[model samples]
Target: MPTYPLLAPPPLSSGSPSAHPPSIVTSLVPPMFNAQAEESPKNLILKKVMNELDRINNGMNKSITLNSPTINDLEDCCVKSALNCFQSKVLYLSVPDGKLKKLQIIISNELHKIVNRVSDCKPKELEKAQCKPCDSYKEVDSQTFVQNLKTLLQKIYASQP
Candidate 1:
């Protein structure tokens, strides 16, 4: 059986000049953390959804712009694209470490919060800003954000086996 808490080089071949096996220094190596106990994707998403529901109770607390603006007026598409690209380029991402759903929820919540804010409504429960907020967001803009987020949520729901 192999030894524990101690190890040394095995004996050399018959012609080896050195008689002794190399001595190994004993040190307490810290136990490496392989991973954390992560929440299931569905549960995590549900928690966010439920939290938003609780916070709103009846309806939004922030003021929403009556009629959100047009593609040309409401928000700068260029800025959105630039930020998206910049973040993708700079963010440290790895498969095992990626919080994909959390990222999606945080971003989606921010956009929705922007809409509600103009309406004079309360931000969603998950409304805490985690990243740069969207600039020039308005209430009377195209309904793209709502539709896009709805579809994305649907896709996420359907994608899970």
Candidate 2:
């Protein structure tokens, strides 16, 4: 059996100044949200959206034979396409452009519904040889073709200074 030491530190009183810890941590100031901040880190969310779009666009062109895609891939592409459609429609809206409050939250709920519907699945074998020529012909998967067209439309409508 080990013996306990008799000496113990006094309990801190709530009123004592020394009881408070020195705050040496510096808090970073968040970038101001305005027209200038539009191009700053404030637009990181927008960048995330663009990155997802790029990833989906790239995935659409992946070689069917090399990738050996399953039905899950097709379902994923469709789900992503639907989500992006909702995201793009709301994410770019200026405050003055829409009367809806918490547009992001609204879009989030819509995306959640899409995901929930496909939450459970069993993988099944898919025939890849039938689509092998698609990669060679630079064919886009119809599953993601609408998104591709939407992206091109966005590019066409883009404004510059």
Candidate 3:
């Protein structure tokens, strides 16, 4: 019967001075497997969702064209992008125990608050030189909506296994 070699080669003979140093042996061996290197599918999906959310947040931070767009117009853009993100990405994410669904509802409610606040103000009120809403909305504050969303997203990402 033929005998097979061991899975690992026998240790190098210590008597002879080796041409290759011990560092060379360490370098030749492949690095240990890292769980983080292979991100879960859910993690990848969440990353994409967060990226879209960041884009929306960044867009809101910049001052748009100075052509005097109505507050409603700006709010509408934010709302539409948010809804699109939920529909296209967040809804389909595979999260544990319906967490993604819960997040969706929260985001939707916040967007609605923004929409209602913008709509409540009469065009004339906005037209007046310096009258902005006192930033009061019972459901959600539009001014801090992006920050709140980011916080929620961070919590969700950290909860991932």
Residues 30-119 of candidate 1 have per-residue lDDT tens digits of 666768667555535634644443333222222222222223431222323323322232122111223543453454454343333222
Clashing residue pairs found in predicted model 2: none
Worst 10 residues of 2 by lDDT: 61-70
What is the C-alpha lDDT profile of model 2 across 1-161, one tens digit per residue? Answer: 43423342333468475765554333445665576523433133333444444444343423221211222333422433333344443333223323232443454444444334332322332232222221232333433443543353243224112
Per-candidate clashes, comma-separated: 20, 0, 0
Segments of candidate 3 deviating more than 4 angstroms: 1-31, 35-37, 61-143
Which lDDT values do the candidates have, in the order given?
0.36, 0.36, 0.41
User: Candidate 1 at 45: error in angstroms?
Assistant: 1.8
Compute the lDDT for candidate 1. Answer: 0.36
RMSD of 3: 15.5
Show where candidate 2 strays beyond 4 Å.
Answer: 1-77, 97-101, 119-121, 124-161
- When summed lDDT is taken over every stretch of 10 residues in candidate 3, the lowest stretch is 61-70
Cα displacement (angstroms), candidate 3, residue 100, comes to 22
Ranking by TM-score: 3, 1, 2
Tell me the TM-score of each prediction against the true structure: 0.23, 0.23, 0.34
Best by lDDT: 3
